[model samples]
Target: MPFPHDRPTRGSDCDCLPRPSDTKGSDAKASDPKPSDPSPSDPALPVYVLRYQDAWFGMEKRVTFAAADLDAALAITEREPIGAWAELSQDGVLLCRRGGEPGGAADYWVVD
Candidate 1:
């Protein structure tokens, strides 16, 4: 099915609304219809940005990866260095920050 962006705008002769033929009917058998929720295998999963900054050296690195939610992002942060600071952002907006201080929150802060 064509997304809104892919469709023709108003006043187009073809209308360009998604054609009913593009979708399966109720009686039709679906292909991969039951995709697992929040799984890495799902191509529609949301992508998040993880930025790491060294406390002393001020070195910075950014990683973009797919995650289902904040908890998944926290799980990925477990592999980061203990003393380094990390920030999780989505769509260029800061979601939370963690690390860089002794006995900080085990997970992250400022966002659920």
Candidate 2:
């Protein structure tokens, strides 16, 4: 069947897929509309520290802090006594060990 614009159908001997040369006079995608999503560059996201427990039934330590990103979260953790006390997370996503390690987690965090 032919396309709405009368373009050739694929696999029927002729295909109307846009070619490099056909893009010279106009840009179809550039003229189309699209819904933009929030990017890392957007300020909608913010780093947060999620406070949880290392062990469910132990008083060894109280809470944990996971940085939303590698920003102030990790930096603030440097001065904190992590390791077995609390773990780190970013953007509500837990990172590193669950029970906590050196407390100095990685920058493995992302934003929408």
Candidate 3:
């Protein structure tokens, strides 16, 4: 007996994928949707500075980044594998702090 090499039957009539003619224009490419860099002073994401004391040497250290709020900033700090205690600041003003004990506390409180 001979084996059949015919193509498989169509599964459905619906076309889920978009066709090239449905695109915005002929000049449009898949990679053309790159977003512009956000400005440093973007209001949606305020800049924050995290200060902490090195657990091993007790030397002060700092890190800066943009976050949605103090909670987000603290979340980012918690992810870092650094000093046990850290202070989150914005515009040189202290907002909150975390881990201020010898054994390294797990909770952080607002400065106010």
Candidate number of the best lDDT: 3
Compared with the true structure, all predictions reach lDDT values of 0.68, 0.49, 0.70
Candidate 1: segments with Cα more than 4 A from true spot? 1-43, 55-58, 102-112
Candidate 2, residues 2-98, lDDT tens digits: the string is 4545654553444346566567987457756554653434465554454433344544443444333556555755554433445555556665433
TM-score of each: 0.49, 0.29, 0.54
Residue 82 error, candidate 2, Å = 2.3
lDDT of 3 by residue, 14-81 (tens): 34555555575776576664455554566778899988887678888888889877777777887664
Residue 2, candidate 3: Cα error in Å is 31
- True-structure RMSD for candidate 1: 13.3
Pairs that clash in candidate 3? none
Best by TM-score: 3
RMSD of each: 13.3, 13.1, 7.5
Over 24-88, each residue of candidate 1 has an lDDT whose tens digit, in order, gives: 55555555465454565466777788788854567897878888777887787666653466788
- lDDT computed for candidate 2: 0.49
> Per-residue error at 97 for model 3, in Å?
1.8
Is candidate 1 or 3 superior in lDDT?
A: 3
